[model samples]
Target: MSLATTKTSKIDRLAELTAKKETSSGASLWREAFRRLRGSKMAIIGAIVIAAFVVVAIVGPWLAPYAPTAQTWRGEVFANQGRFVGARGENLFGLDHLGRDMFSRMLVGARQTLLVGVVSMLIGLVLGALVGVVSGAAATLGGRAGQRLDDVVMRVTDIMLALPSLLLAVSVAAVLGQSLTTVMIAVGVVQIPIFARLLRGSMLAQGGKDYVLAARSLGIRKRRIVLTQIMPNSLSPVIVQATLSLATAIIEAAALSYLGLGNPDPAVPEWGVMLSQAQRFFDNAPMMSMYPAVAIIVTALGFTLLGEAMREALDPKLRG
Candidate 1:
């Protein structure tokens, strides 16, 4: 065989091997993360619990046998009025003070709880990301101006962080008055500092990396580099933090509601409101509090577990 032909054959063979290697090791980051998540039993359990809550939130009212607000009298009381009864055939979870079905109220409350959690999370994520991205990008300005901008933004975040999250949320809720919207806004505002600080730190760390420097050397637009390259790379931690923050938002909303700072209308069913009302009947019907409290604990646990598992999966240092 000619020397040139032999060299061409060797080149073709090397190309084939490279293609095979690429095919064998070409999984995307998300796909790898998912594979790691699937290997985690806690993650699977958390996912199942979260899915159940989502299903309950979506179809709970339809699944309930009784109207959340309808009253059913049992024993006769003063002036021929019948007193409320506990659990019965028609009412699986039993009756509240006014003879309202506990199970039905709980079902409706699930929808409210999930709605507040999701909406508040979205609000926090959007506002926080914007603040963090802007603050981080400002560092590119360099010199005294950059330092001043960073100091100003970070001081504002520090001021917010100085207060306890719950206290801040309570203050906002009080100002907004008692309503679901108030609870959501309060919780969302509380979350802003946390996400902003986390994302700002992430972006700052990424800004000093080789890839960012390379992009700068290529003369990429400052905005484009920040948005497209730096932001996307820094989002893994933010996404994990978001999942954890969702659980916190849910708990905070419930707390505000329990304080009578949420949905003033007594007829409205919400986990926190239900817990507040259940206080009156605690002696006779402790299950009222039990149900709502258990629901809150389980939901929070699910989110916590899921967030931890995601962190483990996504972090290279944690991967086995």
Candidate 2:
């Protein structure tokens, strides 16, 4: 065979192999994400713990051995007969001052904690994404106007970032008054800057991609292109950000609760309020502190692990 023909055949084979390799790599990416996630021992453990807590929260009432509100007071001092309640065995978590079951309260508290985290992130995402998309798109109102808006938004974000988050939540919760809804709003409002910053950066980065430029060249509506094309492309980063934000939101809610700005009813078994109330009794009833503290730490750790896994999976640079 001619040398030129041989060379052409080699080039064709190389191109074919390259195409197959790329296809195989792309297919393996999803599988690799699951493998990496499962391989992270801490993340897997965290996921199990979080899942267990969620299940407890969901079925707590049914599993509770006694009504959470039932009080068993005895006539004699230090000899209370119907006083002890719930899962027996010397009261593993013990009873609160009001005689409510600690375990039950913790189970119920899960709903509150999860609610605040999810609701806050949702509100923050919507508001932040709107602000970011408009400001980051260079076509809208010329580059100077966009830059000015970005500057103003970023400065506001900086001011918010400067303030201590826990203190901010406490003050807001105090002003708003303690309630589940109020807690959600306080946490959500505080997180707006985070989402805005994330979205702005993502949008700006995505806007410069070839597909985005092609859309622009094709005279696609800026709004449609941004919403339909750019937004979808940026979701991987945003999803990871959201997962991490969930952990932050949970901690913030706990902080607010610790300051007595959480659930109005003291009977509710929330970890933060439990910690606040139990700190004084730490020397006497350490169980109170142990359970709730562990819950918060474990839950937060779970979300953090999930976030890390997601980041590694989606980011080609980080993936091995």
Candidate 3:
């Protein structure tokens, strides 16, 4: 009846509406992601392409007619020795110098590439989130000590950003000496600055919000405030950064592998390694270069599309 009571009722009504809307079938995050994804034709196509690659990567061994590492004399052959030019009958993508099945190898290569990319990006996400949260929330709240640490972290980030990512991966991989694990670490390290900077911005924006201040005023532990209050609000941008970083990380891994700085064994199937091998046979076997190249491009484009769609979906201004 009174003005204050009416205002309280309205606030409660708004909260109920918001909760209902958020819980609706198409209004949840994943559903919203799918909805926004469908709105972009290119993103949808990219998703399909990426999904196909994943399926192929998973089932390729079964589908491949011959062993990827099998070596036969008589120079080389492909795809059960069919009329597909590089088919070679037994070699789907044709044979390398050692008569290995290019198609079979490529199938295995996709799995390795995806593994490196996803793993490296995951490492970056964890490290970057910690660093960014500490740099932003701590520096703002910790006073001079936090500020000093923040400055150091920012300088490191700047130095990292100034370095070419490929060059960094090459340098690190060169020192670590070419193993799949090392390749993942190298790519992940290169990606940390990207995540850190984005996260710091998100944290700083959320740090001074009313809820955060209220939590602080309630004598909540700094960790709780940072984790619960500031962190939640900062997550949107972090998610966006993560999606984009997956693409960058994949490229870095591929470059490292291509340079002979990944996968200690020459026999290991990796798209980059396949490309490296194909270079020598360019004149005789152009398709050798084409398939892997197209695969990498399509995969990268898919991540980019997905990232763009995520950004748009998460953007409040764009969503309405």
Worst 10 residues of 1 by lDDT: 14-23
What is the Cα root-mean-square deviation between model 3 and the actual structure? 10.0
Model 2, position 68, has a per-residue lDDT of: 62
lDDT of 1: 0.78
Candidate 1 lDDT over residue span 196-228, tens digit each: 766777777677778789988999888898888
What order do you get sorting by lDDT, best first? 1, 3, 2
Off by over 4 Å in 1: 1-27, 74-84, 140-143
Q: For candidate 2, what is the lDDT? A: 0.67
As a whole number from 0 to 100, the lDDT of residue 5 in candidate 2 is 43
Better of 1 and 3 by TM-score: 1
Q: Please list all clashing residue pairs in model 1, or write none if there are none.
A: none
Write down the lDDT of every candidate, Cα atoms only. Answer: 0.78, 0.67, 0.73
TM-score of each: 0.87, 0.82, 0.84
Winning candidate number (lDDT): 1
For model 3, the local distance difference test gives 0.73
Q: Please give the lDDT score at residue 37 for candidate 1.
A: 93
lDDT tens digits, residue span 85-107, model 2:
33357454667655666776677
